[model samples]
Target: MRNRLNRRVAAAASAGIGMTLLLAACGADAIESGGDASGGSDGGVDTSAGIDCAPYEEFGEIDGTTVSLYTSILAPEDQPYIDAFAPFTECTGVTVNYEGSAEFEAQLLVRVQGGNPPDIALFPQPGLLQTIVRDTGSVVPAPDAVEAAVDEFYGPDWKQYGTVDDEFYAAPNSANVKSFVWYSPSAFEEAGYEVPETWDDMLALSDQIVADNPGGEVKPWCAGIGSGDATGWTATDWMEDVMLRTAGADVYDQWVNHEIPFNDPAVATALETVGGILKNEDYVNGGIGGVQSIASTTFQDGGLPVLDGSCFMHRQASFYAANWPEGTEVAEDGDVFAFYLPPIEESAGEPILGAGEFVGAFADRPEVQAFQLYMTSSDFINLRAQGGQFIPPHSELDTANLTNPIDTLSAELLTSEDTTFRFDASDLMPGAVGAGSFWTEMTAWIAEDKADAEVLDAIEASWPQ
Candidate 1:
């Protein structure tokens, strides 16, 4: 149920907003397993958690208000958010109606254009936020409180990602490190191989693996690009990682912003660099199938071959730990683990490629703003970090909140002065190409064996004119 009370997009776009959010609409709350989400009746609130309401008392009488949150984060992974919201709701009588969908990236626009967007959206990509803001003019700017929290807790670059056209609209929420290559330490020890620290070293290892195999029974790496509706994103991740290493940060920015064409020599060279492993028959699709099978293989299963001895490495994000089987231990000296996808050249700093979710609000209702503000605070950051898969964006996040070694490593790289951090370029580019042509062309390049230049040219041509 989309509860707007009587407020439409026109009113929500304005600066002044009242309690006209979702209360009058009669329907089941998305987050609740059962029962009508009327929040609470008059003169009462849910105090089951026994949280001090002092912090929430400033929001005025928002006692039975509901704010709907919609995002791509799904079950199991979505549980932490729900768990964290309990304290907030217990303290402030604002019930949060949460919905997670696999089709969020594809269907968000339809909802926005159809005048039924959720009260708040967890945007995986900043580009889509910009697109909706510029095209529809329906997204409300962040409240003063939310903006203040961003200024206090987040870095300047994180703030910049949420601001568009000089207006701050969203705040950084969750983050993940993508510059990781998952592997098994014991397997390496048994095979007498060591972790690679540079691009050249990684390649040498790949070559040695192929030579060792001789018959190509197991390749050096395993990869996949298959994500429903958002297929080929993994390949784009590879492209972004390679582009960062080869073209340098400045060139990567130029390419993402379209200062240089997607087919520019620098970008094409990056593609070639990525292809050296992704396209090379001796390098990828280990344990799964041939290189072409990459198109159909789910990204979740991309790195699984490392466990079965069919492959030695799986290049993926830190979140890949979630894909490991229940009993599979993930540690430096345990059954499986990951290392940074080494720098291309020995330098003072290595580039870190990461992605994060931005909390963008569609309604300016007090309850909506309250939830938005809460999301940006250090309190939420700490609670969210406990959820395991999350890498909170706050500089103030306690190290004790980091639940795993991989997340600790990610937080270290994210905050380390010796590393240069950049958000995923595809997430910052316009959606037509970033989420559209870029994904399709990369899939074709891998599965269809399309020429690198053709893939580049096609993606460049699809950029918004």
Candidate 2:
């Protein structure tokens, strides 16, 4: 509790609004965003966000209402969400009291256990949502209008994530792509190297880079798993990506669900595959240091080496673009760009590894329900998409609303029929393991050179009975 940074902030003030026609077009099924307008007795709500306020009328009057929000997403990544809600607040007169903390997972539970939970929480993953649902008895199920929006816009698999024992409790708020290998396009062009389409090709490129720079400062890969208390999560992402490729989706599910042991032979194979790059002294810590440096370097700084030509590739999510220094170009012909991480064989399979936040409520008040439901709507999502570094998960999201090219690509790939998508495995497992031993053991695997089997055995042993 003492370590938690319980900083409170108001949503970004109302910004220039242009999609005034969106709510007016949600058709008959549009769920009303509850809350009263700041309108006077005779006058209706004023449009500070400059959009039509009619859509919110259905949620009923919520005059001068307030909703409290808590989450792990803090500034600078948090400013966009704050700014995006401007229009919603302007129309609904709901004051969203937001508090973002670094220790959200630990503190959220503390708050709940102490019977002072926030009105809503944007869970980084459903595993925590499951914990709250199964153990805390504090999570409020999604309202009818919220359920209708999800069913109308999302596939069953997404809703299943928030559902526990057949009861739905949340909706996806944002998404990210984890299967990207960011690189310097100009560097690749200068070296006459094309983006690899298969795992073998990527390895060949790695070998080529090593052969070209023998004893030189350049390396084929640079990575870091350090993220404060979340250290080693990046390594877990590496493991999950490898798991999706080597073991395929079915076995991957079984492993995450504990139908198969964490140390199952197949999972060990996946770990070895991850080791091929991450654990390989020849391939990692380019701008950082020795392979062990990966455990100490920050994940946000892990891939920055690409910009300085010290490393050739950094496998991370699309959201990593936000980490680049301001004014850095992120485009095909610009300073940096990302390629889809290749699979073992293009024809064999190329399942996407990804993650998203689930918006769950602790209070069932109409004002809270209104805000949660609005978050799932295309209007809010589309408006939010323009804020950059955000991928709209609404199935009907307008690509035009996405301001960045990478964001557009992520959104397109998310719904593309040609590819398969799966959420992060660590975020899906039980918290005791997924959020615990799995992280600590991975750090040891890199920092101490612990044998893969030993690390796997430790994690498997930690699984709850």
Candidate 3:
């Protein structure tokens, strides 16, 4: 279940043939910025109108030419954009050289370092935007119009992930809710279990499920930690959720922003709590060591049948619904239900895991701004929803238009909850710690008899001071 294919290819495939046409229209120069609008040594565009659509009178056309884009949208997901973008290309002669997600960062970094960066880069990870702001001078400030468009589509807080030091580097793109617990209605009903509304109730329910299963045939939960290059990230989600619930939002923010050490007592407690579930003889399938060995890809799928309706719950991001076995009851009926990971205690308040694409401006051209507006607009959400994609970042997406059950569930979670949503902690961490050290340490904590403090210490030590 590791994503073997390059994500860029998937992104391009999602964008479809419009990508081909866009790529074809590119001029001889790979980094063409069109005309002499560079405005010399000033290094900033005229943001008087901000990014207003009115100033876009000549938005579609750019001095008898079109702008080209290099992006990393996957195939299936990119299809809608491709379809939507065709009109943009036709309306404006601007072309886009859409690239696959594979090695896009490396490719773009090389280009930028070589003095030939793309006019725009659609980065899927938010941390990369911070890197661009700090390391590469390639990214420019957001035009007034782009910021207005972002506020219009996604709310003010939505821009937090893309903004740094009071300047915007990226715009919000598609989003997926991670603080969800998927359960089987039939299994829960057969067991006479009620959906737990509070954290205590949730644990009490898990305990009840375990007590009911005297024999070892049934497990109460399914927890998988496999994600290929990012295997340990799943564990980081659990830790973050628990931290948010047990320690509260202020502490959670500090941890995420690196103001508090990762090895702080609160973080350690979260790790221990998750480890307890893995270590408990009655909680997880295949036990601690077995869970570690279980491929992350198959972990979510394993919860489908639940060993004679014994297993009741699986916690994962919204993307997990797509991995359900095809033609299976869950898959056939779109059988999936999600509930917020209720706060650890009533006093903790509601907390959610929010992760998504962070779009940013590379150049200040009318076509560039227009394309960005189009990509993040409500129209784009509608198009993607029609194709059964997960939740769109724009909160205004009409639930009636969402055909898929998963999309419906995601939509409901967005509007119903009165919680603070935080992006995945690991995703926000530096690459070395996020993808490398964290995974190995978490797996060790589960598989071996490692001390919680030691694990936390190791993670804290790894953070880039």
Q: What C-alpha lDDT do the candidate models reach, one value each?
A: 0.76, 0.75, 0.59
Candidate 1 deviates by what RMSD? 11.5
Off by over 4 Å in 3: 1-121, 212-215, 286-289, 295-310, 328-334, 361-369, 393-396, 429-436, 447-450
Query: Whole-model lDDT, candidate 2?
Result: 0.75
Ranking by lDDT: 1, 2, 3
Estimate the TM-score of every prediction.
Answer: 0.87, 0.87, 0.74
Question: For candidate 1, lDDT tens digit of each residue in 74-185?
Answer: 6446656776676777677788887876567778889999989999998888898898899999889998888888888777778888888999999988877888899988
Q: What number of clashing residue pairs does each candidate have, in the order they appear? A: 0, 4, 32
- Measured by TM-score, the strongest candidate is 1
TM-score of candidate 2 against the unseen true structure: 0.87
- What is the TM-score ranking, best to worst? 1, 2, 3
- 76-135: candidate 3 lDDT, tens digit per residue: 344444544444444444565554443454466667788877777776556656766778
TM-score of 3: 0.74
Cand. 3 Cα-lDDT: 0.59
Clashes of 2: 4
- In model 3, how large is the Cα lDDT of residue 129? 67
Worst 10 residues of 1 by lDDT: 20-29
